[model samples]
Target: MTTPTVAVGALGGTIASTSSSADGSEVVPTLTAELLVAAVPGLDEVAAVRAETLARLPSPSLDEPTILRTLQWAQAAVDEGATGVVVTQGTDTLEEAAYLLDLFWDRPEPLVVTGAMRSPAAAGADGPANLLTAVRCAAAEGSRERGVLVAFDDEVHQARWVAKTDSMSTSAFRSPVFGPIGRCVEAEVVYGVPADRIPPLKLLPGHAGGDPRVPLLATYLGDDGFIVDSIRADDVDGLVVAGFGAGHVSASMAEAIGRLARQVPVVFASRTGSGPTGRAMYGYPGSEIDLVARGAVGAGWLSPVKARLLLWALSLGGPVPRADVAAAFELRGRP
Candidate 1:
């Protein structure tokens, strides 16, 4: 008969934005966690809630340091005996932020993230609905051990597979490979599919000082090797090439990638967003087979954003062996 404690942390986004004046003026993040939770009708019916405002900036303004700090805050909430935690931020980087948290959230309690596509002042604001559903999902016993979740538009998506597929509309987030694992209907959370658990990467708290900068390059038609050549002269520690189709670049890029692979770690991901990068599908110049033979690690099912984060994390632990880098993806990059 007792409700579990659910901690809700608010990082300012459209969910918290409001017009400064009654005459419909400039809108900004002006709502606090307490205000947000107060707007959610029947939220108290699900769980005992605790609210806190961690930041009041758009999600795009958030950097790695801010994200790392927020992660620490979430951990502290978990340590304080919160059964589950919900975070509200901008939808622009919700998928990426959730994925980053998944890599570090080594806990069984659900960490549900949600945000509104429309501002609170807009017609038919979704913030209240999303916040309420996020709390319900977080309080559910079935949501535990499912990794970080992005709950929006009544659907719950796993962090690793979810992406922002649309610019507008409430149905913006989607998992191209794996669909929603759960949905919130009439304040009840129903899980439709079982989610696989991925081992969290080993990243110590407050130890994100010197993560290596890894640049991602998306290949295009008639693309010369100028960018790669330019990056080769820079101080970047790693590169993730988002190749066309199933990972194919122009022949000129292949030659540059071949040369760069010898100097630094090169990860090949698909610019198409989702799908496995081909390993031996083609043997022609600039083919996936050719790139793999030239030591470009195929990023199997990992998006370019996630691939970049993984490579950066690996590089932060000092010079990792090439084989170890390949094994990291092989072991943890599944969709």
Candidate 2:
């Protein structure tokens, strides 16, 4: 059989970074996609690889337009007969980037996103191993139709559920609600639990119009909703609230949320690291039930960032109906 072709695109991160100072102190992304691919051992035996440097910015500097460009690149790669695709970027924003790609990646071939927690200058840097496993996962037959995946530490997680849970660990990325859906063992891919695949959002013509302003706010103790009240409905296209446990917030914030929901879409998600937002458990003034009654939608399992992305994507085609936004949350927010 012909070797499967995998296209690797580099969006510079720790995986492609090295020490920029003579003292070996500060590290910066300096390697190209071809250089990263060349460092991997036994990668040639797995698949025929095509490498390209899409961008050289740190993950934090990566914006929505860059991600959309990468998405288009991946689609074009698939059209060019590449069996799969691997995206290398900084781990800092890997989860968010992967999810953003997942939202519009309407393809059967796997698009795996991977990044290194440690820079190439660090002891035992993990870029090569992570990239190899990501390629293996991308080449795996089972990975098809699985949507965009975050491959890290030999584990494969669905983009919708994965998040960066730690700041300085090789195992920082995790699918908190459910563990990884698959793992690469001995250069072979093994899938454990099956993940539900949500249909990719359709991008209408001129979908790249203006950047939508959707801010994410987290509730805390004694929060008086001053920040929420300060945001004018005319300024923002949508809002996402990372509410207290099970999607509850201060009574004052809930009132402000209700008022804002009347003007624009408001999505509430759990602030806790794991678990879905409560739908109807509590009935208090600031409970999920109360928020729903006030027109805010519950982001069942989506994190605040992901919820914000969804709201932003929805509003890109102009003002989305509140019911339509709620329906989107109901579908994509579920596990």
Candidate 3:
């Protein structure tokens, strides 16, 4: 029997959107799977589209349970011989969940998460079009080998490389160092398989939102780092410092991070959130080069949460190779 194509849904972000046009100002989108599917055309022919309304929360409001629930639903789809999975979520924290799902799923099926900037009632609205394209990508046989992907604004990006740049631009999602896997046209989807870390993505026990154990602290000039003191005094298990560009923490923060790393893992991530976190990329008060030399683990492209997740996994004894996790955020050619 031929491997049939099917879809699994995890309602998020724009996919569950509603228009504010009727009420005048302050029209927040009220999203529903039924409404979103009706908006997209040609999805029926592509695969067996199924919807799971896991949450109606905004992307930034997405929590750990959101990640786990969506993953669970997708895993069931794959087990039942579904060829692909599509997730519709808000753009704000899309990468965070995408990276998390990519790490959690060991299955060899495509997981594509797509969301939109414009809502259904607005002119130049793009949600329906993006959703249709995502379904097509999920249905495409070629997508299976690519591991986890996030298809947005017609561009197919590998999960690990994509970042949401614009607040509300059609050209929002971009993979700076690497371009998209390919673009989805009306007729077809095209892309070559990339060299991604195969299954056995060491399982990492996730942390809930507002966990007093891990504090993500930022460092700036003349920064008192009272938060750091608070975190230390209260027994934070891990700390992620958004150091200066290129991953440098404040001098005082650096010293504090160094001490903290000895006690708990101190992950260095860039506030830039788009580039690799490494030394020698810039000259500043707290350059990453110094941090790495100080035994601080540099989170190459990982945003703070991603870096935290990876560390939490490693600390919990997940076998996801350190080098693989390192490669997740490192510069393209460097990886």
- Per residue, candidate 1 scores C-alpha lDDT tens digits across 133-162 of 899999998899998998999999898889
Number of backbone collisions per candidate, in order? 0, 0, 9
Q: TM-score of model 3 relative to the true fold?
A: 0.84
Report the Cα lDDT for residue 25, model 3: 37
Give the higher-TM-score candidate: 2 or 3.
2
Worst 10 residues of 3 by lDDT: 203-212
Candidate 3, pairs of clashing residues: 13-90, 16-31, 17-31, 18-29, 18-30, 20-27, 248-286, 279-289, 301-329
The sequence of per-residue lDDT tens digits that candidate 3 reaches over residues 171-288 is 7998767779888876488885554654535444443222235567777777655566556623655678876676776677766666655556567887776666775765444567
* Cα RMSD, model 3: 3.8
Q: Model 1: residues >4 Å from true position, as ranges?
A: 21-26
Error of 3 at 15 (Å): 2.9
lDDT of 2 by residue, 1-335 (tens): 98999999999999999886876668888899999999998999999999999998888999887888899899999999999999999988889899989999899999999999988777889999999999999898899999999999989999999999999999999999688999899889999966458889986667744478899999999988899999999999999999998899989999999999999999999989888889868999999999999999999989988998999888888788899999999999987
Stronger candidate by TM-score (1 vs 2): 2
Q: What is the lDDT of residue 242 in candidate 3?
A: 79
TM-score of every candidate? 0.95, 0.98, 0.84
Question: Where does candidate 3 stray beyond 4 Å?
Answer: 1-4, 20-25, 192-195, 198-200, 204-212, 279-285, 315-334
